[model samples]
Target: MTGATTSVELRAHNRVRLLRAVHDCGAGRTRSQLTRDLGLARGTASVLVAGLAEDELLHEEPAAGRARGRPTQIPGPHPRGPVALAVDVREDAWELAECELGGRTTVLEVGPHDGTPEGALAPLGEAVAAHRRRLGHRVAGVGVALAGPVRPGGLVDIGHLGWRSVDVPLLLGLGPGTPIAVGNDTAFAALAEARRGRLRGVRVGLHLHVDFDVGGVLVVDGRPLQGAGGMGAEFGHMPLGGGDRPCACGAVGCWGMDVGANALLRHVGLAYGGGRGRAQAEHVLATSEEAVAAGARALGRGVAALVNAHDPEVVTLSGLGAELRERAGEALVAACEPGLMSIRRDRPPLIESSALGWRGALLGAMESVFDAFLTIEGLELWRRNRGDGGPDTPERQNVTNSTFAEDNSI
Candidate 1:
């Protein structure tokens, strides 16, 4: 590549790195702080900041001089720019939101939709298109959260949605290079919570999103476990339930049928349909505390099985059934204890609600976008600008060169 091309690539990479740093840090940080943290020089940091500010990808505010350095400007979310779109498609409804780099979420639209494959895609496409028209080219990418396991290349086979071998990319009309990522909704939510929410700083953890179906993600050392073909952490399908309950996945006695939100609703004598009747759903919500306690006991058993195997430090609950964590916290913990092996029983995992609420999946999607944009080569250039007082370390140089070469090759 020419020098100009290299410079452009480096600029894009550093800009992405800055955005990711802001995101990872949660509350905004000053440009000087970011420059220091990322090992970049003051001038290069200012140029990167100016470029991002021009693109409306970042906003700067004058600091109040709280510390013992020169007056610095704090970086904030841009008022306008490329934003990520996230769609959470449940068996009962769908929610769409816009997320910026720093995990800020704006619920653009939400409504009920039939759970079938076709029924889910049509409205989702419309929502994406409408948002695109409204926001124009500022939209970066779209992340779709599905109710069931999303196979490699975005194929889905959700039994509850009645989808068999559905190609999500084609259904959504996404073209080449538009960047559409699909994952199990619960897993994605868990990833988001771990990276930026309740599970932050946890070395090992799990997140269970309790809704119509039970789904979860496993986080080890801050990274979610992606199984062969990115289909890991399907905890709901574990066979732990009692005699012969048929699961939508065509299994007998799947744990999901016993502790998922649908199971809880059924336990409470509520019907299972996405029909227009708020009264019944509301009533179930009203009495959900007790039902949640019952489900929590069952969940505790399943989690105990996992703890025995994986030994996660903590577990967080998300989705509609996350209320169970609050209502049956002690009971769930108590139940989990007995299921653990004697050696493991003493250190049972802590169970808590997801601090990200229902927006966890969307935030995870945004993280994916940021991950793609920040290249190692750019980070090296950033380090060079920081006046580290030496040539790039051999390891750093080689990694950066390999990364740039890989990107260009792609």
Candidate 2:
């Protein structure tokens, strides 16, 4: 490469590195700390920090008195920096929040949905509109989390909710001007676990979110391992033996068929949801009932099978899966023992529940937004748009290197 080209690329690379360091620190990091951590000399770090401050991507706060030497500044997100509009659509309801650079979330609204995919779009649009009205120029882009499998180009399949290949973008009508990123809610839960929940500091791990049906993603080196088409990690669909009952997804003997809240409820001769089934599942866990025990054991067996296959260092569960672990945790551990192929029998992978709870998916949704817009190019675009007095536009995007991809996995 030419010298001028190399210098420009190096500056861009340094700017990106600084933004990443501030973001990785979450709430705050001292400029001194950042210089050392990012392997930049003091003078270079000062220039990079100043450049980011000019773009309003970073804000600096003077640290407390140092008795021996000059004071340092704490680096953090600009108080009035860009925010990502994050939405999570579920079988039960929909939630919308605005997430900023330091993982700060301002939940705008969370309302019940009519249990139909089409019913979700209008309210979602309304919520996004409401936040836009409030946050104004601060809102940069949108990130959506939808239940069930998602394909490229905004095609979503929520079979249980009667949505098949629905074009969510067209339905919401966000327009070409505003960039929207979509992802599977299950996958986001795994990402949230990796970022802020149980799997923190785990370089190689698996996160299984057990809601209506088990789904999740693998995390390696602080990033979710998205498949080629971003549809990988459908662990629930893994066919674990026994039972002929057809799943809502049209599969028979799927692991999802034998685990999670619905499966556990069905094992005790009931249905999933609020009332008797919920009460019975909770009550049975404290007892020696065969049905609940069997259901819990099935969960452990499935987990063991996956651990053997993937060899993740830690396993984290969310939603109903977390509840189940808390309820019949010992049963799962005991059941996993026999299923392991002799080698892992003595020492199985460490398993825990999601610290982010049901909200893990929502948190992950924000992460997708952060991954997309909290980049060197994205911030520069945001700054230019701010100058133009408009929301983030597509024309300004020159993303040479970014933390987020086009998460078109609708």
Candidate 3:
């Protein structure tokens, strides 16, 4: 019995590795390539692929434009396989997207909201339910990226929206059964950066998204460092600078007061609010060069402070951060210089803009759900869901209520 259990565990582990390899390779890989990547024999790779295909988790299709020798088949995600619903809640808008196993995402819907919890989530929830009904059990999970600090159990602290301790799961109205994962919008963006964006493969990286405010995460070896209650990288709230300007979070001298869209709008004497400030900030960026320079300088200083504290290998900026650096030019670099320590002055962390751009958070949300449903236990559940006569093991029975499945709901 023990030997049998060991064999099962090893098979499960190898299967997971195989699926992950296929997932990481965006366009898909031939069986021979997967065999080499996973260090498995050709026969073993064939067995794994056959099992996944039988369960409708993956499939093998003829490689496109294959030249001559032995027609190669690329293993890819099954067309009708389980998918993840990704919801991105911005300052003034909400977006929903669907991501399949291979990281291919299709935007389903996008609309503006009034910044109120119910106002935003009610319509969003209805949309989610509609998709859930249409897709049925093929909808494996849902991931929400909110523009705020997300506590465990889907509670959120959206300071700019004047919302505190909002119960996201309750507001989302998905009730029970449907797996949901909620996280800080910027943290999710950083996750996407770490996995599929500019921060990929870096030992240490910093990812900041400058929207209505500056928010970020410090990723080490592809994992974002989540502080207690998963609120570690609220860099915008830090008092790196801003000179006594009261912030929407009720904090004075927050770095956010000097950077991001809200700060730009305020500096340019344009109206700024959680529900309706983004357009004005865009206008400022397009017209008010002075405000752009000021915000960029502050952003650079804040980046310097974070680098001094964390010493990341690279810094990736998304949203307006890239534009700020481009427009501010040398002034931003100059602002960052004074804050750097002398030893680090020679070669500070390289700051670059995220290539994923606006899609970061949405992609990250997809990743979060994929992380949950792509596990060994998750595969067992999937097999069982297909009524494939999978064993009724304790792991299979209990996997549905795992921490990532139940506790991360939104």
Candidate 4:
């Protein structure tokens, strides 16, 4: 009901900011560095860090080889600090990783499926439960990237998996107490590109994580332009100007139907399924010269169409699409030039492969999980983990019904 920014809340915000400033600094940050970087006074910065250390969220490590000046300790993630769980669920597999405040990630497991995404839920739940038991309350929050369209009220519709209106939190056995952040896989990949990879400095970048099909997000600033119900940009669903083939998404002529691994597989007459996608694409690229050229040409046409519609500063691709962009090379560029407007033909957006490679979705998911904890209520969560048993604000972010819109300063 309250729409006001409070004083206590302001302090909590600053506390989280200071913690993040150090966390984002990779290895760690010195006392003086934290002070200067966070714009906090020396004593104030020390006090804030002391508070975090007391809560076991951060710790001070000695400057081992420093020969001169005051030997200052750099702030680092406590061995038993709060860790965010990052999950990237594919059509037939899922990867779970633990990310620390200091940006180090440990892949806990990658479980495969039996062509049943619905059945995958049980194992996913068990894995999360196991991780929670191992990490205790330090298992802060979870960021999940789903290979499907997540509808309003957290309902997911994965056409490939034949899953509709799936409640992610309930299926994962994540009770109401656990804060869960969910996003489309490709959108989160674009987020990864923007924050940690090729789109790092590009303002109007478009990240297309081409796998089974081309799905991506258009980044305006640093945030992906989310659609209604958080379905993300859903670029793949756009009608192809070429194909009449039926899409797995229950549509005909979808760009997704004609311009991904499936398309590549079909172009060379290969059996279709999520399992054999990578192997099939690799085989065609490695063995068949004609198939490789044909696939790349198709990719070129699709990329050109998308670029003509959305003038992104850069287009970063992952998976087989990236390989196509590479192999296609000048043929792809020349194919796209005619599609571009006269002015844009001279300076088309750069098409490049993902710098983060396979880890992009995982890293982006972890970032979301971490951001869920960088809020007013999150202050109390950290305090509670440190055994500071006290009544606090509601265990929810200050903003309601929306993610990525409020306090994205991180």
Candidate 5:
């Protein structure tokens, strides 16, 4: 390629590296710190920052003057840019937040819903439209966090929503070309925690978000393990109780029926009757403590079984039931102890409350959009901007590693 093209390609690569560094930081990184972090020259960092600022992907603010040094600009959430829209659909309500490139989120809308498929889509569409109107043409993509399994093409099968293989994308009236990614709410929340919250550096971990329903995700080496056909980590539906109470998934005694927030509400409602709302249900009282303890035991049992099978290093819990982490943290740990075999009893995985709180799912939804925008395809687009020939392609051929090995030496 030409010299100009090479320069452009290099710049694009540097910009992408910088963005990745910022994302990896999770909290925010200073420009000088980023320059050192990415091993780029100051001039190159300035150019990359300028280009990204022009693209509305970054905003710069003057750092607080301290000690004796030249003042620097700190990078923060950009006001203008391709904003990510995250929608969390719950059994009783829905929440929508607008997230910028750097993972900053602003709640735009949230309200109650009937939990029906159509009811879910209407408010979601309105939220997206409102955000689009405010953002104008800078809106990049929409990511939906559903309470149940979502197929590859954005079809959601939520028993609580009375939805069976419903196409959420089509119902939301999004254009064909617009990018939309749907994920299980718990899985996405797990992704968010792994990427930006407490689960960072955990090679193997499980994240459970107990809300209106019990949902969870298995993360191994920073990637959410999506099973064949994109449905994975349905930990809640796993059989736990004896063959008595029927579950929403048509199974008997599923773990979710006894452990999720809905279950806690039901437990309280049965005793109090029609008096428990979100606040009342989440209240930390003696009865609430007992209910939470029961849920914790069920969660511990499920987690222990998962540990024996997957051998994760840790498991984090979030959502309404996470408050129980403070009250029943030890009980949860103790309950998990019996499920382990003799050899593995020496090192049981730690169970902790999620650091990201309830926003984990929303943040994870934003991450889905970020992944799409910062892919190899995006690199190809940057290459085109530089007029480079494009990436190198190699023929598919299996080569034995032994071919590269030197002869045996004494």
Candidate 6:
């Protein structure tokens, strides 16, 4: 009985590790590569692959290149397998996308939305429901990225949009049983960078997404350091920029007042409200050198303050932050150098633009959903539903039911 329970647990653990490895690879791997990477015997790996294939979670194809030996097969996400749904709810727009294993994402829909939370959520819920109906059980879970701080229990706080304590899951109308993970937009974007974008191999990294305002995450060892309540990185709220203007987040003299689209628009004397005036803001950055200089100076100084504190290996920028870096150039550097600590002035962290672009939040959301769905319990349920008794045969049922001390490890 003990041996049987151990075997079941080990099998589940190995399966999870295999899936996670494939997902991390981004391009999938051949059977030989998977076996070698996982350190599993050839027969054991074959059995595991066959089980996953039978459950419709994985499929194999001929290796891309012509090989010398037997035509080895490469495993990948099953064509009709489960997909994680993701939604990036921006300040004035939203995008819905789906992702399979190996980080492949397909944008399903994109549209603008009203400022009101109810108006924005209803259409999003409807769109998700429509996709659920079409895909049935293939929809593994849902992930939502919002332009705000997300607290526990999915409470969202979008300061600029004037929204507070928004119950994202309830409003999405996906029901209690539906697995929904809601998070901060910038945090998700940072996660995307840490996983598949610019921050992939960095030991410690900082990611900033400058939109109407600034927000970001601090990543250490490829994972975002989500604070005690999961609302840690609100860097824009820090008073790094010397200003007296009130911020939407009920704070005065926030660093955000000096940077982002709002700062650019304000510098250029354009009326901005509810995430509007992005076009005008861009035009201002392009046309008004003074506005660009001011915004860039503010952005660089604030980033330098953060650098002096966090000491990250690199800093990656996305959205309007990238534009600021490009437009500011030497002026931005001058502002940053003055603000940096004297000891660190010689060699500062590398600051660069992220290549992920708008897809960062969406990809991060999908990755979050996949993380939730690929758990041990979730995989066990999937196996049971598929009725493919790969390891747990009838004779092993009683033994498998017994609890073990290490059951929680996986």
User: What C-alpha lDDT values do all the predictions have?
Assistant: 0.70, 0.74, 0.82, 0.73, 0.70, 0.81
Highest lDDT: give the candidate number.
3
Between prediction 1 and prediction 5, the one with superior TM-score is 5
Which pairs clash in model 4?
none
Misplaced by over 4 Å in model 5 are 1-5, 241-243, 266-280, 283-286, 376-410
lDDT of 3 at 276: 79
| Colliding pairs, model 5 | none
What does candidate 2 score on TM? 0.87
Model 6, 179-239: lDDT tens digits are: 6778888888988898899999999999989999888779999888778778887899999
Leading candidate by TM-score:
3
Per-candidate TM-scores read: 0.83, 0.87, 0.93, 0.87, 0.85, 0.90
- Candidate 6, pairs of clashing residues: none
Ranking by TM-score: 3, 6, 4, 2, 5, 1
lDDT of 3 by residue, 1-410 (tens): 22336867878888888888887787478889889977898888888889888888888889989899989999888887878999999978899998988899999999798889999988998899788767755776889999888887788989879889988888888554447889888888888888898899999999989888788889988878778668777888899974797788888898877888888988978787675777678889989889999988898888889999999999999998888977885778889989999977888999898989889999888888888887887787777665322213344334444533543421
For candidate 1, write residues 363-402 as lDDT tens digits.
7766665454444543334333232222124443343234
Error of 6 at 123 (Å): 0.5
Better of 1 and 4 by TM-score: 4
Sequence-dependent TM-score of model 4:
0.87
lDDT against true structure, model 5 = 0.70
* Number of backbone clashes in candidate 4: 0
Write one digit per residue (lDDT tens) for candidate 4, span 241-315: 377877667887877776666767777888875544666767777776666666666666677777777888898
